[model samples]
Target: MKHIAHFFLFVALQILLMDSLVLYSTGFCFIYVAFLLFLPLGISRVWLLVLGFIVGFTVDIFYDTMGIHAAASVLLAFLRPLVLNLLTPRDGYDSGDAVNIHTMGWRWFLAYTFTLVIVHHTAVFFLETISFQTALYTMVKILLSTLFTALVMVILQLLFFSSKRERMDYR
Candidate 1:
């Protein structure tokens, strides 16, 4: 339920808001990737895959890119649990904790999100570009865009999400 709502909101934001963000020919990034980063750790793989497909397809519709973003987002979703396990905290996670500064601590969450975001962006850019002739430039764009988007995601997490062990709600 929550995941479905989140997926829709992120896709809508990516379609509408991502385009308005511009900077230095690479200063902007669409933040829909945050959905994967912030999702609950225990969500089923099938749910994650579906979330990825929906988010991707929605962006595909908006971008007219023939589901490229959907494919990339699915790739990101597939990689998410691997990254999470690799970065799992020793203290253990609460059942409904949001994977952000609040739950994972700022340092751990930053490292985790940054690493995953880079991977996601790398996959997205290279796949979208699909050629090494312009790989250098495309890599630069991916890095800058990843930085911008990751920064936005971190800020938004800190600002919007409150991981209360008491109530256990994202809102």
Candidate 2:
């Protein structure tokens, strides 16, 4: 139920709002990827891939970029587990843990989000260009966009989600 609402919210946000936002003509905030990034850590890889494709396909429909978004999103989904494994702490994630700033702490969340966002942006920018002619420009776009997207995601998480630590501290 919550996921359904989030799906619509993110897709609408991307199509209606974020699609027009371009920072300095180089940074693009693809906040839709936040949907995939914040999914429960215990979710299956197959579901992640399916959801990634669905979200990307939905965005592609609006952007009219054919399937470039889908391809990049699928790649992100495919790489998510590997990134999680690499970042796993010695104690491992709890059974009910979520991939969010609140649950994982700021450092781990930033690392996880940056790693995945960079990969996604690289695929997106490179696939869109499909040539090395503008390799430098593409790299700039990738880095700036990654930073922009990660920043927006972090802000959104802080604004909407509260952690156990926050709740306990409030008392």
Best-fitting candidate, scored by lDDT: 2
Model 1 over residues 1-171: C-alpha lDDT tens digits?
Answer: 766677777777787888787778865576787887778877778988898887777777888878777888898889888887887779766656667577567788878877877887787777778899998898888889878988888888778777654234443
Question: Model 2, 60-137: lDDT tens per residue?
Answer: 998998989999999999999999999998899764566768878889999999999999999999989999999999
lDDT of each prediction vs. the true structure?
Answer: 0.78, 0.88
Model 1 poorest 10 in a row by lDDT: 162-171
What RMSD does model 1 have? 2.7
Model 1, which residues run further than 4 Å from truth?
166-171
Residue 76 displacement (Å), model 2: 0.5
